[model samples]
Target: MGKIKKRLKNFKAPDALLLICILMAMVSILTYLIPAGEYTRFLDPETGKEMVDPNSFHYIENTPVGPWKVLSSVHQGLVESAGITSFLFIIGGAFGVLNSTGALEALISRTATRLKGKEKLVVIFFVTLWALGGAFLGNFEECLAFLPMQITLCLALGFDSITGVVIGICGVAVGYIGGVMNPFTLGISQQIAQLPPYSGIGFRLVLWLATLTVTIVYIYRYADKIHKNPQLSLSYEVDKASKYREEISSNIEFSIRHKLVLISFVLAVIGIVYGVIVFQFYLGEMAAVFILLTIVMACISDKPVNETVNAFVNGAADLLYPCLCVGFARGLTIIMMEGHILDVIVHSLTGVLGKLPSIVSAPLSFIVISIINLFVPSGSGKAVIVMPILVPMADVLGITRQTVALAYHMGDGITNLLSPAEATIMVALGLMKISYGKWIKWFWKLVLLWYLIGIIACIIAVNIGFGPF
Candidate 1:
């Protein structure tokens, strides 16, 4: 009990739930402080997409949400975000069903026994696999389905939960920020900027490689340090209480049923990747695949239907806190939209960026967008909102529009690891039971390094006139 208290002390921020409520209140107050304004949106004939008119900015009547409405917005946020909310629930329940078969455990045990001395290799392999998914597929939220499994694998290998988190979440985040071929951020931003799809691939490829290299090295060192001395881990106390540790054992059996389950798991994952790339499957489709996987696993293990249902329910029950975190985070966006200050904030920031000289503006574009990401966490959403204005701004300032897109993508992705406004990130933190403060304490230095890399990439893009424009 004393040990638990010591671990709780390391969580320097308020509980995740309280911190979200505090954010809700703060955004509500901004509804009063910030003037209400909006930009007119129009459909782009070229892209068939709705985009903000760079010229339209007008004050609207202030609609400051009071404490009562601020409180009520939580339900509205959940309703507004019902698709993703349901997606989390479905996946949680599905994974719950999958966990009942004992296959995941036996696989983890067998693999851990064989790879006992090659822990670093395991980290590198999984991190790289996740990075590829992010870089090529624009995968962030989808990665959550694998977080518990990855964390378990790391734990079985005698590393900490933070190590699993870095492997799963941070790996994907860096890949996303690199944005080499990510259709969501880089693709949409390019189309909006009037560049051919993937026009400046060479530069982005180099940037992706550079950023990923740094991420891999940093993650490996941390994993290595923790593996050597578990006491050195920041989450040492929290991890000690985890049930996953109990699954680690040398005498674990790897039965035929487990092998069949493992094969089915691999095939299901492969099918998901194929469906995502070939058919553009989103959350709904991915959820269906997981449900199918769960059923298949249950059949292979010959688990009774009643037992399976109970396991599914129990598994989903575990994810309630994370789901609430996501819903509350969505409420923050709802307040901003209702207050009509979201556009005003963007317009104001762009006006400041427009005034800066070209050299300063180039890199500063990255910094500005990074700041903006706090409010608009969606990459494609920001592309439509900010790109239309930035395109012309880049032209006037003699900065390549490609550089502007690079700035947009980099700025859009790097901060996701820390932003409470991001649903998936908050979900990841909730799953790991890590506080935002402790996350910052662990991740800030690496994020700063990524920011520095982004700044330098911006400067290089500027000096070299990166473009086929």
Candidate 2:
């Protein structure tokens, strides 16, 4: 009992996040299982006509069994999606290995030396880079690779590790939601909503820039404070001698073998970027590249090929539980879609609030989407689910689809810093030993303010007839 208690106490934030996600999934499944009202009929997209069927739509459950069965069914598909789970595992494993490699340390050492007196500037630069990169790259994984460097830089700059955690994780999240060039979510949403592909790029660009600026300002203010208050900075507990010993113990120092590992990682990155830019490879192929790269890196580091494969496997093991949890969350989407719960939720909200004027409707839509984001973390996924409803509502309310998109972006961006659903947030919190509640207490005010700024910017943009509006 004592040993079990101690082990639980030592569990990291990522572990906690995974645990919580699992619990939530269980609860969601239970909700699905409960007996409920009769399933309602709706227009089937395939037939473009109204259909009446008991099992075809979601109902208000009065008992638990039905919902749980639906949830279980959805989970099966999500778990079977090799692309999503494997991609997550590969990224997590690569990051773990990279951190253990001391390449991150070298980068941070160089950055610290150069950024000694430019703490505020560094924060702004990184915020802008992450936001822009996230928007362009369209994958959160790209930001994940650079996160350790961001944390090291923040520590060197005398800020709390939480600051780097927030800026890097949430900054990319913000840009991702407000994506200007993203072809996946944004393009799909626009197309489904009867808008042209990349139709509102000019407007989205303005919003992205504005949101990025706001994020930079918020981080810079905090950076200035930390620059002055050394007490708040990261505790650099490892002395130079200890660091050397640790590096040596981990066998992470530069050597002929290590150099080859680094070269392999570099080439992998090149392949990924080229594939993304020129070939437009999907995420599955992108994940395969990373998996293959990790194997190559392990081999080049002098581990036997089989041992290297096992090392990657072992490193990726931690991801399995969390990926399963993510699978459950994905199942929620499938169930909601299958059950028509999504339509119900959207219809209820639109019935009550869809009649407002454009100016009022825009911000309200943003708030609703942001609130929804608390439950659904994937921006692309959420956009797909919500844009259909939001677009029609916007059209009815005399608002443009672009305005609704801007609102969705703002709401999604502002909440990333606070949502426990975000995997990167869990990773950052784990590395820093920061509690989710504590971190939120520290940054909630700033997040709220940033949201306000974003809303104001949206209003201004709408007034100026930006994008489709």
Candidate 3:
């Protein structure tokens, strides 16, 4: 027993999968302790969207998940999350086909060689590009398609996978926080709150600029540190073992095939943006674009049909573990859902936060929303769940609905990278081979910094009456 106790004491560093399972178990247990409750959902006639009626929350029968259900929920989680898991697999397979042609490696090598002394500029450009995509296009899962290429680019530029993650995940994260014109969060949120769409642009632009600047600086500093001393990087060991094809000659020629493949990739990105903006493309449409791009890229690189098929299969196989992470991470939410405790937690949060003074409540809303986002990672989904309650609460607390909206936006964005249940983040970490524990160790400080910025922004919004109302 002493030996077992000693072993337990020494146990450390659970991986993403284990961490997710642990979370599922904890949430399952909470189903009993925390009474099951739900808010009556009503459809907004004007917006034709469902909104949770905050005042209608009432205790319901507890449906606690047993140990067997905890295990079964993992499979149920995968089934429920089939859309995203399959999306990950398809993206993985598509990149698999692309990688087999060596076009991505060749492009990275050529670009890295030419910009050897200008790595800082490259990081800034890509980060800004990703931020714009997120801010304007409401990109979240869409960014998954580019992780392999992004990670390769970072490695080629003498940075680690975490650097790539920051550029992609954190950059987009700040953009989501900014919500300058993000239809997903900002638009859905304002509509639910019965405010004009994109109504508070002036202040939102400021919020965007502040968050973007800090993010850029933070990423640059980290990249600079890791560049100066590789050992300083949290991802140093995992990155060292990464199969990034670093030995590729920098002087490798950018042949016609490589150029064609790269051009096709560029066109594919443009297509995705246009589709999203003009036609309201979601996962299905985006996946189709990637599927087509995969074929175009393979054809351009002159990969034989059989070879391409094999490469695609192998590539998809390589990502099997990471894709599984997505499903397992979803199981956390599934457990909470099966146990019927999600709304109870949401109702509890709003109930507590509603009692605070506006001055205190406005900023604290960020914290409350951050906690709530752990259970509901979907931006639009959370907006529906919390906005109805927050809107009325804001009126009583003498704060603008816009302030609460801002709180929702910033809190949701910041925690996306931090939430273990966020499938996209888990998938990104898996692709980079970074453990969730390591990511948190490296990322918690940045999250704190972002929270500070967000809280200050919320306070200012409250003071300035940031609204067109």
TM-score of every model versus the real structure: 0.96, 0.74, 0.96
Question: Is candidate 2 or 3 superior in lDDT?
Answer: 3
Candidate 2, which ten residues in sequence have the lowest lDDT sum?
A: 239-248
| TM-score, candidate number 3 | 0.96
Clashing pairs in 1: none
Q: What does candidate 2's lDDT look like per residue over 372-467, in tens digits?
A: 776566666676557766777776777777777767766766665555555555555555554555566567777777667667866775676655
Backbone clashes in model 3? 0
Q: How far off is residue 66 in model 1, in Å?
A: 1.1
Alpha carbon lDDT at 204, candidate 2: 71
Could you tell me which 10 consecutive residues in candidate 1 have the lowest summed lDDT?
243-252
lDDT per residue (tens digit) for residues 163-244 in model 3: 8767888878978999999998998888877788888888888888888888888889889988888899877887877875
**Order of candidate numbers by lDDT, starting with the best:** 1, 3, 2
Runs in model 2 with CA error above 4 Å? Answer: 1-85, 96-102, 119-122, 152-160, 227-263, 303-342, 422-424, 465-469
Residue lDDT tens for model 1, 339-446: 999899988988898898878898899988888898888888888999988999899899999999999999988878767888887887877787888788888888
- When 2 and 3 are scored with TM-score, the better candidate is 3
Q: Provide the lDDT at 55 for model 3.
A: 86
